[model samples]
Target: MTKKRHAEIAGAGFAGLAAAAALGQRGWSVRVHEMNSELRAFGAGIFIWDNGLRVLNAIGAYLDVRNGAFAAPAYETRTDGKCLSFQAINGPGQYRLLTMTRQHLHAAMVKAALAAGAELVTSSEAVGATPEGELLLADGSRLPADIVLGCDGVRSRVRDSLAIPQERNKYKDGIIRVLTDRTGLKGGEWDHVIDFWAHSPRTLRILYTPSGENDLYMAMMAPVADTEASSIPINPAPWIECFPQLAPALTRLGDRGRYDVYETTKLPYWSVGRVAIVGDSAHAMPPTLAQGAGCAITNALGLAVALEETDTVEAALELWEKRERPLTDHTQRRAAEIAASRVLASGMKWDDEGLRAARHIPTGAAMPFVDAA
Candidate 1:
């Protein structure tokens, strides 16, 4: 038998919204509190993989996602538009990556959750917590619920209340992004591939795709001091010097304000007591695998499922921690590997001969797979 519940979720990002939707559909009275006056979209695009799409489908919002965004059907590797490694995921069961504006995805999730009977409160932030529930807003107003889930992100206050779990390390890196009007590039040329330019001490990674409405999205990554703010530009000329391959498309972004840049930040411990964390709050990874949002959505779904099967809130948190920690921890470590590869002093490269041999060393790979219920 399904039990009725009242759940309070902190943060309105992808993970929190997904949690709200999943819980509301299962008969929980849910409220999502956001510190932002309105849902804010980061200035970039995210590639939603199949695993995340499956969870969205489970919550009955896949159609909204599919219809509201563009799709990336293939992948290509290039150094300044010159082909290097080409990979296409067209086989049956392979995921058709959905590329869309972060705001659109957030809006879709928020709309789905509200329509599913969730109460969304804007400009609300969680400031404190008790063993029983969360304390929201700076005024010390209490929001008591059967469960409190912290999806508040890397600098989460909910995590602070629990035990102040420290971040494994600082992100100490930055990324630049641009959403172009239209580059007239599509089909086999554009496909669903991300072209990367490896310039030592200044690596460049770009995700190029059309988001259905003729807007082409591109994101570039570079190493930066931890003190650097997101407001800095990644200087396209230095990028060109390192990756002579993207000059064609990079030049087309001229005078357009689409080439914006931002910094990355993260935290380590994602949970404490009845308050548990999901997504970037618990484990923020770089965009190497394009799995940041995917991981968040999956982690949120896992929390919702654990809550559904548990009899008490504490039990639910325990289950969520046990199920999610290992996966997110692994994801974070792998992301570190990817991040190291992008740096020159790190002496790490994806195409390194030793790394290539290690990948083929017959070691077992353990990726978290969502159960098909």
Candidate 2:
């Protein structure tokens, strides 16, 4: 009898957990090791576009994640409180967008991954994967697996162990993210996500979206230099001057954190030997596109499909790389373009192809089992 395939996934973030859930559902014995004693979630939100929803559906966490989300039919762009473009994003349920807190989505994914029978080991840090198909844990013990997946995120030690050539670029801006309950905010759908832009002093943009239950996610983007000055006021007075619409949400800032934005070019290659990388470990982009987490989810589904189509570990990794690399590379480029435009209009070069392909993502979309593998 053939032995059941097993996968070792490092980290318990959305990508790791979702990939675990996907592989476990496919009859693969999956073990996920999280470096943190307990998974930590920031008081922030995420944009799960239709493309991402499709992957969630494939992994069996779509409905549960959606239950705690607010789906919006429109994406509005505003300048100085005046609506510039209110684009209707209406589509079939699969082609819609959902906004919710990272905590809720993470919690749902955790439940799905556990239910799917993926073993979750906490406080376990992966040292590296061996050529002999063994995963070296920090405690000097080794876990055997058919494959080792690096879902350990942007600062992935697995990716570092591969020693592949990679490029890292920092955006010229930083973000201030805050989460607060929507106690007194009025008007709009309350569930809607809005992008409000400001032109005076310097180009800046703020995103407002619903997070969890009665919670709001807001992030203000500005030049990194402007934010470096300790004298610069951290309050909302100047922001309110730029865009008055922010007054309602800014009045209730309960928790906040500063985010330094960075985008890394695609890795030279995502896999070597029995080890391979996924999610931000492969491509980390600025939030300008909001597709970081989305791509992670899809990568999980695609990798699972590749595994199902092939018997050999090398072949499966190759197929997974071929199918996923191009998409992620293009997404990084597109995200860079969007980030440029957000920072300064002079760098406005859009990815028309990406926009078109993304519009048709379906609710039941799953990775295809191509014969090439």
Candidate 3:
């Protein structure tokens, strides 16, 4: 009889959960450790493109996500209160896109991973990792496994512990994301995702997205240097003056909104020996392209597929990075470029180029795996 392989993953975010589900379905024993007392997603809303949807489907989480998410018919852009462009996103050949609260997506992923037999350990923190496939816990203990994965965000202690060469760049622009009630908000434009930009008085931007049926996600973007616009508890005066149409939504903002500055993380390589880095720990990029979660989910599943094919853990890590890094790197570069320029061009060619990775089929999407009953 063969011994079952075990994987110890740090962080219970999108990357960690996806990896857990993928590996558990392949008959591996998986344990995910999260630092928080309970698993919770931080962002207000998230975009799941075609590539991400395929990963969710392969992991048997798509049905849950679809039931709670909103599929926008089109993507619209407005500048200075004037419509700049409106592109249909639900056409026959177009890739699928869905918007949902981070909480909703996280819940669905948790259900899928749990159903696949992955154990979740909360209030446990992983401080570091070793190349010998050992996870270092915060309480002066080490857990050994066949593989160790660091899906812990930008400040990944696992990645740092391995001394992986990397660069972290922080951009000047940031966003305040809040989820508001959708009740009583009236507008036909609410059916579509809208990007409202104000480049005149200042570089203020709002990304309006409908999530589920009762919630609206609004991301107010402004330079970090702009004290008034970037302040917490968000002053609705400036925003209302700029986007009068969104007065209702803006006024409902609470102090609990999250503010995050744009950042890009580039690692020379994603792994060392039996330990591998995934998601924001390896390649965190600007949200301009909204591919952060998508890329994370894709790579996590790709890692599981590589391990199934390779003979050793180290070899599988190498193969996974080789196969997945190119596209991820390209996506990061494109996202950074768009963020720096602050200009979003609308057209089929532009959209195709920007979303190249979103159209690519993930490694395990076509392969068959045991579905969780």
lDDT for residue 362 in candidate 1, whole number 0-100: 13
lDDT of 2 by residue, 268-330 (tens): 888888887888888888777778888887787778878888888899889888877776777
Residue ranges of candidate 1 with Cα displaced over 4 Å? 1-3, 80-82, 200-202, 225-234, 240-270, 343-373
Q: Which candidate is the best by TM-score?
A: 3
Clashing residue pairs in all predictions, respectively, total: 9, 0, 0
What is each predicted model's overall lDDT from 0 to 1? 0.65, 0.75, 0.89
- The CA lDDT at 24 in model 2 is 91
lDDT of 1 at 201: 49
Q: Which ten residues in a row are the worst by lDDT in model 3?
A: 344-353
Q: Predict model 1's lDDT versus the native.
A: 0.65
The lDDT, on a scale of 0 to 1, for candidate 3 is: 0.89
Model 1 error, position 116 (Å)? 1.6
TM-score, each model?
Answer: 0.81, 0.89, 0.96
Ranking by lDDT: 3, 2, 1
Candidate 2 achieves a global lDDT of: 0.75
Lowest lDDT block of 10, candidate 2? 343-352
